[model samples]
Target: MAEQGSGGNVIAALCCVFFPGLGQLVQGRILAALVFAIVAFGGYALWFFIVPAIIGFIAHVWSILDAAKFRRLS
Candidate 1:
């Protein structure tokens, strides 16, 4: 994943995939931005299948969070 200033947002991205809100919550996005994850998943859940939406969220959250944690060390 791409690293950010430090720790990146890897955790957030990971959480997004499985629990979208988790990563944003971790990044301290004021709970509002996370709403997008829900709306996004909810909106397209039917088209992509609820489970996949969850997976997608997880991937995004993970990538972000991972990048964060990894960047710090880098």
Candidate 2:
């Protein structure tokens, strides 16, 4: 996969801010997007506890950083 530029990545990361997996989807990482969406949303849905909330937060942060730093193939 081609890596996106820093600017693009920033935009992608911003997208992730709205939805955890959206960044990955914008970056062309469908699987990662799905995983993030499922894990975060599912965790929150399955258990309305602190643990799940924390996990979702972590996933959200990860998505942002990952998108910002993600490198794609030229």
Candidate 3:
């Protein structure tokens, strides 16, 4: 919303800690939120497989970092 490392980004990153994509939603990125949610959850749903589980974990972490690093175009 403001800039990278801003308070809003910090809060968004915290939100993502609870659930992947929640931070994107907080940042008003509907498409990104949906994409992250689907990818992370889809991988998680197939957690019995090692690769998918790892993918889910990576996606979750990526979502947090993405939110934390996001900078508005304006």
Best of the candidates, lDDT: 3
Model 1 agreement with the true structure over 1-74: per-residue lDDT tens digits: 34564333655565656654566566656554466565556645655566766665654555454434643233
The deviation in Å at residue 7 for candidate 3 is 0.4
Q: Is candidate 2 or candidate 3 better by TM-score?
A: 3
Backbone clash numbers for all candidates listed: 25, 6, 0
Candidate 3 per-residue lDDT over residues 1-74, each given as its tens digit: 68999999999999999999999999999999998888899999999997988898899999999999999997
lDDT of 2 by residue, 1-74 (tens): 34556778988999998998898998889999999888878766756678887888788788888888899755
Q: Please tell me which model should have the higher TM-score, number 1 or number 2.
A: 2
Whole-model lDDT values for every prediction: 0.54, 0.83, 0.95
Best first by lDDT, ranked: 3, 2, 1
Query: What's the lDDT of the predicted structure labeled candidate 3?
Result: 0.95
Worst 10 residues of 3 by lDDT: 49-58
- Residue 68 Cα positional deviation in candidate 3, in Å, after optimal superposition: 0.2
The regions of model 1 sitting more than 4 angstroms off are 1-5, 44-74
Candidate 1 Cα deviation (angstroms), residue 64:
5.8
Instruction: Give the better candidate number (1 or 3) by lDDT.
Output: 3
For candidate 2, the lDDT comes to: 0.83
